[model samples]
Target: MTQRFEYDVVVVGGGPAGSSAAYEAAKNGVKVALLEKEETIAETVRTSGVTWIQNIKEFGIPDDCFNPIRNFSFCSPNNEVTISDTVPRAAVLDVRKTYRWLAEQAKNQGADIFT
Candidate 1:
């Protein structure tokens, strides 16, 4: 059997960028299809999973969804660097869960997601 799909917009990967693109396009009333190679979207994380706290807030991600990083350190053979913040500057999101959230948003906007 051969199946065919036609869409006004097709977004690939289903990562944050793709999901957001599909959501935006679909919300504008365009037919959108989001294609993801993974059997389960976000089964693997492609990102470092660390982002600024401000970005997390702007995206409406709940505080509990990520763990705040308050201290960090990097060391070389002869040198070292360390950073400590009174408030967390970065947070590590539960990538799989986060991706699902983004994909859900796209689906709610009428984007067809295939993973």
Candidate 2:
């Protein structure tokens, strides 16, 4: 037997964009189903993992989750420069935890998540 689902929106992928879409739609009382291809939502992270301090504050994400690097060093073929006092900023993240958390949040908001 083939199971067919009827939803207001069928969202593919469980990344940041997909999570946000599902969240917003579900929050509006729309039927949403989120699909993720990977078994583990947050497995691979290829990012340098650097984001601005203001973004973290705006997003309301806690500092404890990130590894704060106060200084940034840039190395180019021509030159290298290091800046100090990049306060309250972070560069490293546990991608696995973050992705899992996002998936959880979407689920909690009544969005059916499938992997």
Candidate 3:
């Protein structure tokens, strides 16, 4: 016989938003299910993988997973400018690792993850 499971909340996609939602819901004792059509999470690359430092801290992303960028360069047909900041203003992430981490978090929180 096949077993059936019911969920109070169903989140589609295994991206950052979906994983976060499922994690929060399950952590709060809700029966949450996260679905991903991909064969594996983070298999597809959709984002530029750039995020701000504030967001990284706020989201508790690990430092090892990203590289800090304190300098930026802007170029035009006739003009080019470069600027650097004392503190890292942005970061470049390993998208595959980042998504996997988020999915792991959601799973650890009791969210049923389906890939």
Per-residue lDDT of 91 in model 1: 92
Best by lDDT: 3
- The order of the candidates by TM-score, greatest first, is 3, 1, 2
Top TM-score: which candidate number? 3
Lowest lDDT sum, 10 consecutive residues, model 3, at: 56-65
Between candidates 2 and 3, the TM-score winner: 3
Local lDDT at 45 for model 2: 57
Compose the digit string of candidate 3's lDDT tens values, residues 1-115.
9999899999999999998889899889999999999999988969988999899889898888799998899999999999999889899998889888988999999998998
Q: Which stretches of candidate 1 lie over 4 Å from their true place?
A: 1-4, 78-81
lDDT of 2 by residue, 1-115 (tens): 9998899999999876787788888878989999988886766555655666676566555566567678788999999999888464555655556556666777878899988
Worst 10 residues of 2 by lDDT: 86-95
lDDT tens digits, residue span 1-40, model 1: 9999999998988888898889889989999999999998
* Pick by TM-score: 1 or 2, better one: 1
lDDT of each: 0.89, 0.75, 0.91
Candidate 1 lDDT score at position 2: 100
**What are the TM-scores, per candidate, against the unseen true structure?**
0.84, 0.80, 0.94
Going through the candidates in order, what is the number of backbone clashes in each? 0, 0, 0
| Residue 77 shift from truth in candidate 3, angstroms | 1.5
